[model samples]
Target: MGSVGTRFPTPAVSITKHPATLPRSPIDDDIDKERVAAAVLPQLLDLTAADLTDNAIWRDSLALTGTFRTFFSRELVANTWRHLCKKSTIQELSITAGSAQILRFGPEACWLQASFSFRTQGTFPSVCSGTLGLVPHGYSWKIWLITTILEQPLGFPDVDKLEPGPADTDHPGCLDCIVIGAGLAGLDLAGRLKSMGLSYMVLEKSVEVGDVWSKNRYDSVKMHTSRDYNQLPGLPKTFTKEDYPYYLGSEDLARGFKSYVKTFGINVTTSTRVDAATYDAASKTWTISAEREGTALQMSARHLVLATGSMGTRPVTPSYMNHGKYQGHAMHSICWKNAKPWKGKRGVVIGSANSAHDIIADMVSEGFTSVTLVQRSKTWVLPASTFGALVDPVFNPDTPSEVSDRILLGNPLPIQRLIAMEGIRACADKIPEYFERLEAQGFKTERYGDLWGILCDREGGHFFDVGSGELIAEGKVKVKSNALPLAYTESGLSFEDGTELDADVIVFATGYKGDMKENAKRILGEEVGENLEEFWQCDQEGEIRGAWRDTGHPALWYTGHGYAHARYYSRFLAMRIKADVEGRPIPQWSGSC
Candidate 1:
């Protein structure tokens, strides 16, 4: 499916205008939310295009149009409503009890928002939940944004039944889904599948559930994002504020994963490595071959979910000229546990991404006198304070994760990118000297960081400043970005600019093999992997390619990256798998109107 267009219209008069510029209205507390909801509900239910503003936005997820789409402008929304009303009959519509309220965003933007439920009658009836945001336009309230999402299919278990139950035993026969890996992505999906009462099992190559975080990562690694956004779907209920801080450390996150697994009573088989997976076209089943505790094992399932991780298992290390000639101890960032062993030794970290910055800071804290960070290219840097400011409004301690998730994920990726760039510029304007100082010290930076490109494309060309930026500015940690490394010179690294830095220890903070398709090929054989579409990057429709939905192959799917992606998209993925197992007709995008 293709998106409408990349350009977003900017109107001369917008609902988002500051209150100081617009005419003063009644105070927020004095507004009658019920009256406003009553006045606007009828026009919305009637699907009247005149009730929407010129630049209104309608984000739908298999609710109105039976597809994931974002319609911009009154004309597009009107066309979509015309198309929807022609195909399906609207059976019922009503406001959700106690859902109406006046929502205030920042100092100026105010809207009357409410949640509503509706049903569409057809061969396959769908129950959907939606939120509408209306603003005062001239004499009447007009909708500026409307979001609709599929709650569940008719007669299926409630999607909100996400509580822990007794430990479910592994099925002796064919199961509904078999998930690979027990990391956050896998565990989150498994939890949702359990909530839907689907038969499934999670296989992990490690002996323990959270070993990937506790053992595989660097010792000082902590979540770059805040704690509220990092928790899995149902893990927050078992946590207290004192249990973990704002930013969870690697070990803390690992423990949280263990708690989540125990709380959900999820079926997990540890120490099991999957050797191969093959799909049977005739039977429509996937047979997985593996080894558990040095013994051969095989399992069959109707569907397969590859949730190993966003980044592949192998660490990426580029070969240097005469790398073997250097006698200094060298390793990738993954193998470097802490800086205690390399205390008082001269250390050089090759890479300017998150891991490199983190390792530099760790070495400084551990009393390493001489530490140098080599930057291969320009990196987008944002202060941790700026990052917190961007997310704290939505994903904060005061707000519920589910509520915050909807607001954040509701915007399409293309629109989100534009919004993020604007936010970054606003924050950068407040602290121009921050980037100035780093540039003065020979570190290059991107003016307006491409959050989407860094996240969805390169994945490692950006760094969120925690404390390393300060250390670099203060000259406590040296930086070398003028030249690339030419080769290793027995005791240190030699650069292209005829400069040599002596080092006793060298660490490559370079990232991992991040392509999911390549990882799939290595595990599922070339024949099965080649048939799958590209993964991770965004498609033309502004949706992520080949994740949480179809992968162009029957009996196969992929869960995407990060805690937010895992938490929000897991339920949708589970619903899709259930529909597949039961032979229900799944909705498809019918292209933009």
Candidate 2:
């Protein structure tokens, strides 16, 4: 293995740095961000790994190598650089004009961050973009973190620059792909496919593109995540903060989705519900059966994508004994629109998650005299402000969402979990009473390690407290975790501990069955679905199972979850499908998981 300098001659690279505009803390004032960036660029280009700190992290996604990899520690980074230098040559490198700045999270924590464009000369010349973070170590700065992502192949379609056009409606043969569910995931993939000149169509079951958000959710619902993290790829330039708030409401998000569809000119068929789909291995095609306005329709595609979303469409409501005997007004959280109808009525909300907490808070605000939250299990609660603070370094208003996403998705799941745990602990230390109050009220809180585990395992079972924690702590809202609901009485519910609660309305805030395997089984039949790998949880390799990768069936794919997952993975999924359609070798990494 050869070092970077020995493997390739140094090219004439243009170095440009922009002044940092962020308000600097006293500690950051001593550090010159441009000087640090200029000093670190040459060391990185020369692969002088000794300049990196012992715990530095180097994340490369198909740039230095043809795979996703994270090199931890100075030794690991040096070895990988030497090994890859033998196979690939750095042809050209330059700092992205006006991309260097000092990012300050606090007085004591700040770094010089910059972006660069580079090209790798090998069998396949590839263009890439990377971000570097330099932190002050001792008296000087050291490379603390670097992330590189493949921009495009030498002659491949520049997906970013491709203009939105109408989908291929006149194509008479089987299309390349048919994406189900015209939500964020489906719309994003459609945009990518269209840019790649792939014949694809998006089918939405709802009457409109964003009915899932605007019509289905409860009133007063707002996104827990910030708007930057949730924006889809190829978001229209015209859609600005005026279109959607920092924390989007349901109607605002719906409007944004509508604008995205219109701006991209994506081909979407609305009110189309897919009933069944079967794949033929002989021809490697999928025949889909669907209904639109009671009209049966059939379509054929070489590839079928299940973008119906990770959150299962089927809402799960527990069956209590004698559910129909004494129901005043029983409904699932899905049916909860607003508390206006049940105002001044005694309300009992079952389940202990985001939805349950939000519903309880809404009920209290709506002047409900009595509202009780029945916690069946422990919940990991974190204040919304705390969560925002923890992620502010990456997902702040100043940082571009695309850059923040790469920094986030570059890290493997385990690494992300470990980093997140530190942030959670730090936030908890600042606000210890948040958890103490909830626990004291018998609300059963899991403050640590449970956040990511619950998200991966159940995608629920946790609540980011917006205002509900205070309500519960102050006794404005009641709590019932001592016993489980045993049966329904004429007025309300009876618990196993011989306790009975009187209520006029009972809302089961229990979440949906967010299992992709079960969803596949329902739509694609038992044979294909049962054989597919499990979804959601991290596999042995820490990669999410059965999503954005090959499922058991070659023609089938699942790509849906959060907005960020869709935005980041859609590019890769589209590239994979493009390679398959063009009979090109699909890029694969042989590195260790």
Candidate 3:
């Protein structure tokens, strides 16, 4: 079924058959589907739909249903919320996506909700709602974020015995701040707001925490930025080993978030998403709405924060013949579940970034017949450990072998120089597209945008890190580039160079389009995001503080909004956003400020 196609009768159900019952089936059977569906649906926890548009309510009920998500979960939001006159009584509070009707909840409970929908698969649609549940236990307080996905039979979202509060915003209780995207920046901002004793809510869009890390499971998804610099403030790692750098893997980082959540008692809604935000100047608030799983919900808050961060959704995929027709498994590095499935089978990996390099190495090391890497371009690779083979030297007796050996290995100067050259070569592998585009658009030329571009602009130097490219091209590892892939077939992969190799799996490592444009559109309007020349000019001038809209929309802020570079940008972004919190003076360095 498509957006609208095959329609299963109300309360969809399946009938079990009894063997040798053809005669019985021939007779007319008047059955009550309602009763049967009711009995069967509840027994099953999973409520799946091929396409929700196939339902009658999809068109009309979709929006209304989304608005109803406020009943799914509750969260103990932390931010700058207060009234001017006296010490804020409700200092550091929580907001729950109380039951759909706010009046049903108690006065102490703050009602809030958000519901969202996504295509789990081409044929499957998913919908879920998140609610901030409110409950009281002695003098202490706790808010729970709950979510319920829509079922085929539409079982009502579980409601608490105590009545939830109604959606009434005209009272003394009102949000002073709202922040979206529960990533690094959001968490930091939330912590700051909490410290400042302001009421604020942070919204995130995934089933779990750690926005980028949780969404991307690529094999080589390690932090490229130096761990010494990357650690979030307050999340310090002082002990060091003999190794030059310590690796911070996913598990390590996830643990840090859990600890932070507990230590700060930060309220967060896992498996939730913020879909829409409407700024109401008249009320000095933003009508924030979202979808948790598939249900709907809304909230009101002042001083909106769009911390959706960078790297939006998945990268754009190119059209290829038999992309879906291929019999073998095909997936993006972002969706690489595990190397287990591709084991013992030939794999054709694609891409040139760290992910492609890491995944190909992983696949080959496993039991695959061969792992052929199909890269889009050449790239730099930085190894965590020592790189390549080592050499040993011996000397004459008169010269004392020890003496010759010391001469060869003694001075760290020679080894360091060699390492430096190798590192420079690695840095040279970056794509020249940026330089070419710069030239086309009129930038200082003769020197490319690789290392030289960094010299030109200190602020943008992080984009081109030296020494990463040489390791991959030094021939110490397996790889293929200089030629692009032509097409994917049932047997294997065919590159544009007439090279073909049998492959059992194909993974596209294609990169993501640095698109803050859509976000800019929301911040500004269609004219900025759609009109090309206008966009370029606007961005050239308007993006005063890296990604700000250079001109209009003074009070808003978008943290970590530029292209991929050193992760330091995130910390810098946090500092910038910290300045924007209401009542804080404008940041001195910011052009707008």
Query: Evaluated with lDDT, which candidate comes out highest?
Result: 1
Model 2 regions more than 4 Å off: 1-59, 64-90, 93-116, 131-146, 161-172, 235-239, 278-284, 316-327, 390-399, 432-451, 591-593
Better of 1 and 3 by lDDT: 1
**Candidate with more favorable, higher lDDT: 2 or 3:** 2
Question: What stretches of model 1 exceed 4 Å from their correct place?
Answer: 1-57, 65-67, 72-74, 91-116, 133-144, 170-172, 235-239
Error of 1 at 396 (Å): 3.5
Write down the RMSD of candidate 1 (Cα, Å). Answer: 5.9
**Residue-wise C-alpha lDDT for candidate 1, range 1-593, written one tens digit per residue:** 11112221111122122111111222366777767776676665467678877766777777665556667777778677667755656557677777778754334445677877778775558897787777777777887667778888887886546786667864868999999989989988988898788899999999899999999888989877888888677634544477888878888988988988888888999999999987787788888999999999999998899888876657898788998889899899879999999899899999988889889989999988799999999888978878888888888667766677776776555545655766777787788899988888888887668686567665556888877899888888888999999999899999999999999899999888766777678778876576676657655445666677667676687886888877887878888788777788566666677
- lDDT measured at residue 377 in model 3 versus the true structure, 0 to 100: 37
Local lDDT at 211 for model 1 = 95
lDDT of each: 0.77, 0.74, 0.38
Q: Write the per-residue lDDT of candidate 3 for residues 1-593, one digit (tens) a residue.
A: 00111221112111111010100111112433223222322211222221111110111111122111111101111110001001111111122222122211111222222222211111112222222221222332122222222211122111111111222223224565666766666665555454433456666776666645644565335544333433332322211223233444454455555555555645566666666565655655566677877889777765566666544444656667656556787777667855777778877666655556556666755767766555453333323321211111122213332223223222121121333334344433343543344334222222212221121122221222223233233322335554666777778666678876677787776655444446645643565323311111111111122232221333344544221211222222333333333344322211110
TM-score of 3: 0.51
By lDDT, highest first, what's the ranking? 1, 2, 3
lDDT score for candidate 1 against the true structure: 0.77
**Ranking by TM-score, best first?**
1, 2, 3
